[model samples]
Target chain A: MNRDTVIPPLNAIFQDVFDDPSLEVSDDMTAPDVEGWDSLSHVNLIVAVEKEFKIRLTTAEVRGLSNVGDFIALISRKAT
Target chain B: MIAQKTASLDYGRLVRESRKLRPDGAHQNIRVAILSDAASQQFVPLLKTLFHENCVNAEIYEGAFDAIELEALNPASGLYEFLPGVIVLANCTQALRSRYYEHKGDDFLETASQRVQRIWDALQRHSSARVIQCNYPLPYERQFGNYDLKVPQSLYSVTAELNSRIALYARQRSNALVCDVEAIASYLGRKHWFDERLWAFSKAFCHLDHLPYLAQSLVEMVLSSMGRVVKCVILDLDNTLWGGVVGDDGPLGIAIGPHGDGEAFYHFQQYILSLKKRGILLAVCSKNNRETAIQPFLENPDMVLKYEDITVFVANWENKAGNIRAIRDTLEIGLDSMVFLDDNPFERNLVRELLPGVIVPELPEDPADYVRAICELNLFETSSFSLEDTARSELYRQEAGRRELQTSFTSIDEYLQSLEMKIEVARFDPAAVPRIAQLIQRSNQFNLTTHRYNEAECETMMRDEANYLPLYARLSDRFGDHGLISVVILNVSAAEMEIRDWLMSCRVLARGVEQYLMTRVVAVALEKGVSRISGHYIPTAKNAMVKDFFAQFGFEKVLETDGGSRWHLDPTAYRPPTIYITEKQRTS
Candidate 1:
């Protein structure tokens, strides 16, 4: 449930949804920072992260998510 | 040693598998467009994974969310330019309910049907894409409760009526198809199927957990439209059709009955029997002593399937892959049409490697879950069924007997004449239009032009005899009836007639049926005072067997190209092969 464990799998999900293998999840990376990550595909990314972490994200939580760092912190807090 | 995991594949598993789907090793290149009123972002990756499993390279187009009408109605939309082979419209109940609330009177169902019809009409005008419309699911409300069933104007009643209207419209329109998403929601319990939270937040109508199953149903529709249907199922004897090894268990010892572990095998056999009844040919490819394997089917009192049910039974000590190749040759069907089921992973893998086209699904470790595992695969997706399909196994079994009887004759002509072959040739009957269209889609090896038509297109040609001559042929011999096995679409003109498409079943090959068809063609030309009869040989991967088909009946190749070649013959010089077969025609 640390940043290292959560970020790698989150980056993998981002890579798959965007179809980019080299896509990396930095702390400040937002939706516009990643190619092919539009509003339509945003739900796919959230559901994938929820699936990987074995947690559920509310609609408010998904809308509130701004960056990869915020997503990692939420996962860490939800995991503990 | 039964595995805990059966066919209930969760959403997480599908997503995990979808992420690993890379562009590699796919043979077919297909473009599919998804137009939806709900969140359809998951369909691309989900369908890509499913298509990748089938070795199809799919370029899936996801339209803007809630833009089904926008993309479908506009002639200049990207969907038209994409020219997808298949377009899936996933209209959710959430959006439909909003529209229903605004509509007045019992015209809601009619208006909804017309809206879908407009999309089909626009697509038909602009592109050749087939439409698959998903019906709305039942809404969760109990205001009227049981009274809603009796009320004709209730929203629930209107939705049910709308589904039936759309189904009826799709049946009339060849290029239109309907996917019963409501059935999927009902099958997977309502509690698990619909997630109100997801719908409220993301506008995802169906729950993400049930999306994979919906994706599976959509995949079946897409594959069937492309004529990628599984025709035959090859079953293993020991540990597959029964609980214990039949070789050691004997007929009495085998576990196949109404109790204990035997019930599992009995249920599996019953499922297989259902498939056979619906025209799927059954065959056995097992490594066992011939009599030992045959004894169980013969003497087992609790056996759900008898020995006569199988079209081709190959039971020996030979390797299953080699035996499967023999079965493919004997049945004369594409390897892709055969599905091999064995309990052992080694045998399944061997066939998978040797015959990549053959569908070899990995069974669960336990015998009790065979039916569930196979049902999940959806091996058979037929568009039409008739009396001919019900007797398909019997016809194939009798054809095998004919093949055996031919070896005793001194010449092929003598064997064919002694069989007393009769062919019923008709222009086109309204009742047989569905079967004719299905034959056009399924026939590959003996197809001359490889032009596939849907029922609507077939019916159009059937109605217009002045310009188009559509003929269907049904063959029967001393053995049994073969039903409608041949179709020819001819473009007629004042001076000449051209064969637009000619296809026949591979089972009736070398039977002089094609030659008899030439006689009919020549007769038509003579009656109409046409100078020439033209034919074309379009080359495909599987249709090379018929490259010289037109030439065999004295038609000369006039135009040749890399794509195909055209053949023509003078009507006076046409010579039909001498075969002792009688022809029946529809008399007005």
Candidate 2:
């Protein structure tokens, strides 16, 4: 329910959606930092994240995210 | 395509498999064009993966988003340029909802139906691609609530009406087929089907999780159009058709009827009976003594499927996979075209491991869920139906009688001659076009050239009298009528007559149907003053039975290759085999 618990699984989802095993997420990382992370794969990422954390992200919350830090915070908040 | 159980249709696994897909050289390649109002990008991978699972390599063409009419109406559009064998029109209900809200007309239903017909007409005019028109899944929003049925103008009513119109219109056109996306949505429950957020964000057709089911339906239609169909349903007795074992429980003692502990089995029998009525052959493969296994069908008054309904009944103590192989041999249909349903997991797994091609659907532990479990897979999807289909079971039953009669005679000729068979070989007429096209598509084993000509192509061949002699043969005897059993198309020229396509229904096999037709062909060749008759035998996996077909008819092999062999015969030197079939006078 905290960042420590959310970040590991969130990073794994990122790696899976991008099909990159070596992928790691940082607080400042954004869409530009990841390969194959486009508008199309962004949907896949959101679906995977919702499934992994057993939480649904609202359209506003999904659009409001600016970086990996925002995604982690949203997941941490939703997980609790 | 084999139907997938819901548990195995994992979205993540399918997408990953699609990424790792390699072009299989042995797989038949088909070009498919998808024109949809919704986003088709997510669907392409699902379609590819499902088609690949069926040993078909699909090269898909995704039209620009929401350009169904533009691509269909324009002759030079990329859709026609791709020359798709199948054109899938995925009209999502989400898009239809928007259109329904925007429209301010009283005759919106009429306008919408007419627009769909126009697209089908334009596509038919432009290309020979078979159209797979999808029906709209009903919208969740019901403005009139429970009164939506009474309010004709409501979005819910319009969606329901549109689905019916699509099915009714598709019934009139041979090449056009309905995908029934609404049925899938209804099966999955509409609440789980519609993902509003995904639709608003990415124009997704439905929930990404449910896209594979939609893709499987489309693939079923496409594969059925290509002449891959399940012709027979191989069933197991005991707990499968009825409750408990007939071997020990006795015929009347077994639980089967409309009431009490037998209602579940009664419902299951009714479903199987419906399948048989639609021309799917039903065969009983039980692990019991033959007499005991069949007593329920004869003695049990509550049994919906009677003894005669079964085409090839095999009941013995032999391993079921071997019994199934014998059943396949008896039916002369591809193993892939048969479904084996057994209640026991041991039997299902045995058939699955051995046959691999035969569809073995796992039954539920509870008897009440039997019908639902089978229905969920949608195992018996087909593209064409005719009166011939209705009579197919009777024809196969008579074939069993013929086999019995054959054993009574020492000589094959005597047995064939005893049947007193009559033949009517004539030009393909308008009335026989449907059966003729069905034969062309379904015949695999006895077909010399396995050319799956659609109904449109068959109609063209029927009309082109100047260059083609497309003939259909109907056979009858003391037992029953085998309607339109054979199709032999000949290309006529001044120098020679060439057999372009030769195929026959296996039900009438060894009845001298082919020999009688070949004699008629030689006579026509001599009458027309053609010097030679040429025939080609194309070898497919199923048609190897006819590898030496031309050779038996005194046709000398002229050219040979790995693909096939060409045979030529001098019409003057051809000796017609003595046949028992009396030629019926052509009424025309």
Q: What is the TM-score of each candidate against the true structure?
A: 0.69, 0.79
Best candidate according to lDDT = 2
Shift of residue B301 alpha carbon in model 1, Å = 5.0
The candidate that achieves the highest TM-score relative to the unseen native structure: 2
List residue ranges in candidate 2 displaced over 4 A.
Answer: B1-7, B404-478, B482-588
Interface RMSD over true interface Cα atoms for each candidate: 3.1, 1.0
Q: Compared with the true structure, what per-residue lDDT tens digits does model 2 show for residues B551-577?
A: 998999999999899999999998888
Candidate 1 per-residue lDDT, tens place, B1-588, comes to: 011122355555566577777777646778899998888876766777777676667888889888888898899998888889999999988788878888777687778878888877887888788888898788775459999989877888878888888888888887888888998887677667776667776788677768878887887788776777878999998888988887777878989998998998898999999999999999998888888988988998999999999988888888888889877877788988888899999999889888877888889988788888876566677656678888878878887668657868998889999889999888887999999999999999999999889999999988997899899999989888888999988899557899989999987888888888879978988898889899888899999999998888889999999989999999899766798789765455
Q: What is the C-alpha lDDT of each candidate?
A: 0.83, 0.89
What is the per-residue lDDT of model 2 for residues A1-80, given as tens digits with 9 covering 90 to 100? 99999989987888778888899999999998998887767887888888889999999999899999999999999996
TM-score of chain B of each: 0.68, 0.76
Clashing pairs in 1: none
